[model samples]
Target: MDLYVADRSFNKLGTVNNRTSLRWVRRYRKTGEFEIHCPATSQNIEKLQRGNVIIKPGDPEAGYISYRNLQEDNDGKELLVVKGQFLTGYLNRRIIWGTEIINGLVEVAMRTLVTKNAISPTNAERIITGLSLGTLMNYTETADYQTSYANLTDELENLSNLSEIGFRVRYDGSTKSMQFETYKGLDRTAGQSVNPRCIFSKDYNNVEKQEFTESDSSFRNVCLVGGIGEGADRKLTTVGSATGLDRFEVFSDQKSLSNVVDSVTLTDAQYQALLQGKGSEVLTQNKKICVFDSSIDKNANRKYKEDYDLGDIVTNINNKWGVRLDTRIEEIEEVYEDGNEKINVVFGDEAPTLIDKIKQLRKG
Candidate 1:
């Protein structure tokens, strides 16, 4: 896969033909990233400079050059290493600004947030040129979101996880602009007959290697939300209906969700609804996690991108282990080295990182 370089203004530069290795990672619900290692030639050093952009073949996202390094091997061969995030990472540069209460279709709400803060804010200086919303698909999923002083990307990711939706910021070469859009992958599982099913298993010789993980160490099924009051007057709501041994309870303190906004008081029922929403969000964050990691064979029965792609729901069966999973493709990592390419796929919720654990703790 040849890599092309572009300037900050989206002007095309020459290609990097001497790259030794490239690791490109793409995600369904978050910003993607890439790393490149190449000989430190005059052209390589110039094109890989910070603030430039890297474009992979057939990829809509562009990688922003943020870090660069130079080193010499034992043989005195100079090497240049470049690393950065995809265009979606630009959301990290701004916050939600203030409290935002959303109640509507998930896609519409997401676009509203972007327009308010990034595209056409009340403060004209805050607008990001060449950024606009793409045609809406009008997905049927709806959500209730109330966030304050939060990172734009973090909030969008939270909503995406809860709704099983994905988002991206693709650069349009024709318009020389960026388009933000939401998407849902096709259902290619055995249960669905509309589209051809994609099942990976040893029997089919599609899976080269696989690992399965199931854990409930941080799981919670029930949440008791407390909102906008103290002691006996506290507005309270409970989520989840698991009974007996299945019941796992936790508390979510959302006292900051006030019933009165801009002098208008919400009805008692409205206040209770917000509490319910908060409880539901808490339960979602603290659910059981099941992950399936696999290395796919390129010549296998199901072809990548054609039969299935990121965010597509598919099936995985391991008869010997008696495991069957119908899950979404959450991430795909493409590794190119020595003129060969390999694909690593992660299905279902990925293992949480140190920062993820910290965020969960803070929420709890």
Candidate 2:
């Protein structure tokens, strides 16, 4: 469905948002030539003004109007909501509600409902049943708690607004890593809990290497509330030193990430993985628009430009496939003709999709 201005994370409208779904009316005509104005695009019917029906032109046989709690039927076409499944406007780290993946989804859904502008408030209690086995081991673990874990005790005292918190952990055999999920309670006096997991346990522990190795990749995400991202400019996320919202936005947008050639270091495989959209949105977006700028990685340029002529080959290939995309960026060459040579390069949006561009350029 088409996204209207009223729908989205920014102005979260009606049942989809935390606030009561705003009431919208439409005109309808009855079989006996009767007309009325009631709600639009909804399953549940509400009584208004003693059920006064105001009919108008272009009325359908049965059109549900949006009123209180409404569901956006993306499957077949839920007559009410006319857009995608209420996705957030700006990207934010996901907060984990419990150690189990499913619980996390619940906390998020509940939190979304509880926020400022949502209309329909469904009972988040069902998330209790969907709890993962990991949640049993660590009932305390939740997404919010995990984010504040390093020295969570410090936060407990100051959080008069917090009601509770949850925690849990996960253990990785290969990396010998133990992961945790934490959740923070709502309302004042919000206590926190933690969850931990032992994925390296004896039962069914032996498996293949991984998707993120020297030739693969991996990532970590956190969801925070209780004013976590409220005031900060950046989303308080980390991806190598440059923390705050910038990193969050950068990783989320493939375009911004491309400009950051000096931030986190990258390997051929890892970079390629991002290009292939195998890693987190940050890494994927980063790879989608970025390439090895010769000036920064001189040593890499040395090997590729001299020993294997890798740089030259890439240049030749890109030139062949591209329609005057940026001229090949050569580093070792002297600076006689304009230190920063203007290579005619085509970026995303203005050119082709990332996948198509990479596919076209990789032929050589």
The candidate maximizing lDDT is: 1
Compared with the true structure, the alpha-carbon lDDT of candidate 1 equals 0.86
In terms of lDDT, model 2 sits at 0.23
Error of 1 at 254 (Å): 0.9
Q: Which residue runs of candidate 2 sit more than 4 Å off their true CA positions?
A: 1-81, 86-146, 149-364
Candidate 1's C-alpha runs over 4 A off are 361-364
Worst 10 residues of 2 by lDDT: 26-35
lDDT of each candidate versus the true structure = 0.86, 0.23
lDDT string, candidate 1, 275-306, tens digits: 77677777777778888899999888889899
Query: What is candidate 2's lDDT per residue for 53-163, written digit by digit as tens?
Result: 221122111112222223445565333222111011111112222221111333342333222112221434322211122222223322222111111222221121122
